[model samples]
Target: MLLGLHDHWQELCHCHVSLSIYLGFLGAQGKFAYKLLNDLFANYSNALRPVEDTDRALNVTLRITLSQIIDMDERNQILTAYLWIRQVWVDAYLGWKKDAYDGIDSIRIPSSYVWRPDIVLYNNADEQFTGSMETNVVIRHDGQVMWDSPAITKSSCKVDVSYFPFDGQECRLTFGSWTYNGNQIDILNGLDTGDLTDFVENVEWEVLGMPAKRNVIIYGCCSEPYPDITYTLLLKRRASFYIFNLLLPCVMISFLAPLGFYLPADSGEKVSLGVTVLLALTVFQLLVAESMPPSENVPLIGKYYIATMTMITASTALTIFIMNVHHCGPGAKPVPKWAKKFILQYMARLFFVYEVGETCKSSKRQPKVRVVDGRTEEGGHQPRVCATGLCLCRHGSLLRDVEYVANCFRDQKAAQKRTGEWKKVAKVMDRIFMWIFFVMVFFMSVLILGKAI
Candidate 1:
């Protein structure tokens, strides 16, 4: 009984201490700071209710951004700040803050979070003579989210009597938050899907600093897996993904087709090999395009692949054309005369002109001849016989009689039998086709090599 009485006595002392502090400062006129501490800090003397135990520690990890409001000297500013009180916390407490109305007008922001002053221009001159801030943060999904700690406290809610000292306008800040089940706010609270969207509620804010500090609170949490909270931030990190599956692989395979050009066309294997590679490329392209989103902008590499394949296809076609032109005579085939003319002039120039010059050297011979005087009354010159069929004979010579003439004619007929102009024309055409085909081939080879490089 004595032990129990001693406990009661301690409780009475705590109550008296709390009541006296409140009453003594009831008419307190200047902006004052008051802190709401968890009963756990009161030595548990009157900790009539124990905090509920929970499995998850981090329920809703909130990244709070706070700023200081300077310029209010009003003392009756009934201000309050709050945080979603964590259950069974080791040390949880609430605090009221100060507003910087002193007009020091200088800010020294260090690497640490400390009290400072504001005013001036930089990012929009709105903070006029100051800097705005942006930061990235990670937090756990704890269903128990904090109220705009810049408000008055009522269990699950927060209300700030007055905030934003610089502005005379009055407004209310309301938060949208999750409702709780047994140990945490179940996702079933908001959306019908039972996904975390159920807890998508706004956590509002009111800013002030010093004297009547833009009253604020730093939500308490320093753990992981936050068992009780339903919306798992860990799960969300893996959820955000893209569906360009077909696009990715197609890009890579199409680029591989250009490797076909490394083969030389002269190698008898070139034609069949090129055709096979083209077919394989076509199949792979079909595979890559299957999963792509039907859209306007194809992947960057897709266009490149298309260009390269088209060139290779064209390369294959030209190879076939060159081989046919080389094997078949242009006159015998359906080749146009102008095409033959152009090719012969430009592409076949060296062969046609050079071979013709060689033929002229072998067939035509300029021989030495003597002009002789004949026994006619007037002086006359007679042409002499030469090796190249250019010569003259006396009109009345006894040896040039009918029998002699027949014998000479027979010899000349045998010589004429050895030559034919039609044969020469065919040989010239062959040489012309050969040279033009080679030049075109060289040009096309350069074009293809350029594409590969």
Candidate 2:
């Protein structure tokens, strides 16, 4: 009855020789008798042959062939095998191509612009995905998706995709193929849709070498966005970032924190601004460190951090020096001679004049004021007022208006006196440390910037 029913349908036959495979597997399962039974039942179509079930979607037949898979001790695989798939359609062939430009734009479409579905899937019996630090993309025959590592390599689909990669793009491919025992089935459900518009990306294809193994790994990167979904595969990679862009800015900003040395502690803005910049750099450093891999050797930017912190620490120390000088000091250290004599003269009058001349004559000239009625203008403001400015304004203020001109002159003297006292307080530092630290920081920063350049 089984023979009569099966003979009435179309029969397909393929020989499968599983000598060392299934027998060994059955032996491990304590089912060694199945090997014996298989041998005995080899000639019987009635014993272990197909029993048709009308409920299944695809009809399947099972046959035990009395053959041996070649000993294959010196087996050589075919290096180049064109993929053969039952194609539903074939588009226009790329026989020839021409390159042209519309206006200043380049349009690139060569004879190689032709694409084909040449992806192949081969099974490696030993490769397996373990569910640990690794991940395997899982795609069901029905298209449901999930990811988990399988203990055994029952099935894998190998593809050398040239349709969806670019020079530096990145993408990740997940697997859903899994096997439980030795008899696991790897079904090739096949491509359901073929849409070339689904993937218009850069190509990441390169030939790789494997001596003792067969693999389909070619270099690939992220794919560009497509207009539709057409069974895309991608491999994900962690984005790479430069240490300078990632960290140096914060370190540099932090390094700027110590510049409060120029600020008078008596002014309300000194420590407040310094401490704020310090906190900002610290926070930025912490944030930058989060993106870095853990390493014992500090990054180049980390060295910058240390150096910058050293400079900032020096700046902070100078601020402390200024505070001490303003409050109390020994031997009455004179004010910075440069700040008093040369710096005030050259910087305020000469350097400042040069800067003003450059500002006035430069190509980037903008709106600027020619004079100030005590209300200052932008870009003309300096960090600190020099005694030269006091002297400049001395006779000018002395020539005041008729509205209590004597009182205005007295107030002007008081302001000048305050400026002189501030200078005197600043003079307590032996100008030696300021000049030394300035040159040191300048030289070091320039060296670092040069190296970076």
Candidate 3:
């Protein structure tokens, strides 16, 4: 029993010794971290740059990763985005030997305790210029400090909306130290291009690329060069939204303007149809204007709407004229000889139009002979002989009465013929104008909208 008790006592002693050693090791690490923090900040000043030599410029490397595109306001010319900003620099006073600190190689500390570069976006448009969230800074034993901050930035961007829904835009985000010149602090790009590995896709825009460039320029006020890093975000509009909502409807409505010519003049709706289409195009133009900025450069879609409205307006006026020509009465003047030859003859033949009961075989048919009051009439002219082969001079009173009635009939027929010729001229003009306007719309659509593709 005593031997067994001795064995149990040995096991307890071994466990107690192991626990004490592990506790001691943990306490030592805690002590080392506390000591390092005190030593680093004891003589350090956050206001001064963390450099060994004041004459030598401190290099701060900057890197940005796009997280999401929040919004792009074309009217206001602003670009809002979420980004991950990383800055790396060396602090000469923050380094320590790992052997003296329980093999501590890195530590996390509040950023306020260390010096950070005053880098800011130069073209910020928001009231609050800086939109970064403060986080802890990582310090390595070799004096390297890394600060990763998440920022939601709103920067000014100049937008060119001439092509509108089919347009691509390039916006730049310029970053540099606000107070430090190139001689005091030099900024460097970690990579040739901005990082986009974690970028969230936007519904209305597609990111073509983001390229970064370093620029050093000297202002007139200061001889020292001010350095800046510019990241250009190249974006293209998706265009599908505008295509369905605005462009397709306008195109369909534009074609309707030409169809107004096909409507009959006597229908009384020809002019009304043209006017309604014109008003619809105007409404569409207003919709486009509401979305775009009030700029001098007109959008491609807006140009099309204006052209369509003009054509519709002209069609309405011509429709009114054609209706007037169709309603010519017996008192109206006869259609000019030129109109009969050009419009009624050449243009009528071109448009495959002819008077009622007139056809290709009508010219070959035999003339009709009519007997009126015993007087035979051949063709359209009255004959001088009676149908019974008797001398018409024996009945002088009856002959005089018949001759007066025949003169009245010829006058009425001549008036009716003049009115028919005028109606035919109006129809031929309508067909010619319809085809002309149709061709105009076709070429206009091809030239203006084709550039988008």
Candidate 4:
């Protein structure tokens, strides 16, 4: 039993010894990490370019990942976006021996404690031009440093809203070192295009693609070449919002303009309807103007609204003329021969317009038979009839009075007939103009709005 107890004691002692060794090793490793940080920054100069040779140029690889599109100001011609920016470069002064530093292959430190490239957006439109967030730098044992940060970039973009609401835009974001010439620092595109793997989709705009290009230009101020990387972000506007809010309402108003002609002239609402439609189109045009810049190029929807407004104005003027013709009185002049031939006959047939009945014509009064002074005579005149069926009348004061009354009644009947014909001509012309305006509105809408489809 004593031997077995002795064996258990030995095993317990061995475990205690091993635990002590592990705790000591862990403490030593913690001390080494602390010492490593101190040694790395002790002689490091953050302001210098971290290069051993002054003649060799540093190459910086730049990459951007679009995270979100915050806002696009078309009026101001600016694009605001949230981006993930990555910069990689070699810092010859930041290298360390992994074995001497307790096998630590990489380290993370505050970026302010190291020399960094002063890369900036060339087309910045924001008050705070350098928009990168201060982040840590990751340094590997082989003298490579990587910086990953989030940036809110506001860049100037030339806006073309000719097809607006259904338009596509290509905005560019140019990046390069602000103070460094090509001999001091050269910029390189890390990829052919920007990364979209983590992009958050925006409701108003769709990302088509982002392509990067490198340019080297020699400015007149300096003999050294300035290199830059430009990223072109192609975007298409999502038209669903504008279609429901702006376009569909305008189309409804366009259809309403033609309906003004269908209103009866007697109702006295035809001109009012046309004027209301014109006002509605004007309101829509104002809405379009509010969203777009004051540019020379008008939007497709704006053109459509202008055309519709002009049609409504013309329609309103024609409605007034039609009402004038419809209300012709006995004193008004007769409709011309051409108006009767073209509008009353041909146009009436074309528009399928017809009078309700032949009641519009006055019925002729029959001559009364009377016996006066012991003689049978027609009521119209006292005359002696010859064998040729012609009557010769004798002039007298009573006969003259009767002929004058008959002449007045005959002139009244002819005036009433002419007034009716003029009204008929107005009805036919109204129908013809309605169809003409309908055709114009239809073709104009198709030609302009069809581009969206």
| Clash count list over all predictions | 29, 21, 0, 0
Local accuracy by lDDT, each model:
0.32, 0.35, 0.86, 0.85
Q: Mind giving the per-residue lDDT tens digits that candidate 2 earns over 134-155?
A: 2322222221222222122222
The order of the candidates by lDDT, greatest first, is 3, 4, 2, 1
How good is model 3 by TM-score?
0.86
Query: What residue runs in model 3 are displaced by over 4 Å at the alpha carbon?
Result: 1-31, 356-401
RMSD of 4: 11.8
The C-alpha TM-scores of every prediction are: 0.27, 0.30, 0.86, 0.84
Off by over 4 Å in 2: 1-248, 251-255, 329-453
lDDT by residue (tens digit), candidate 3, 169-270: 999999999999999999999999999999999999999999999999999999999999999999999998988899888888888887887887778888
Worst 10 residues of 3 by lDDT: 17-26
Better structure of 1 and 2 per lDDT? 2
Candidate order by decreasing TM-score: 3, 4, 2, 1
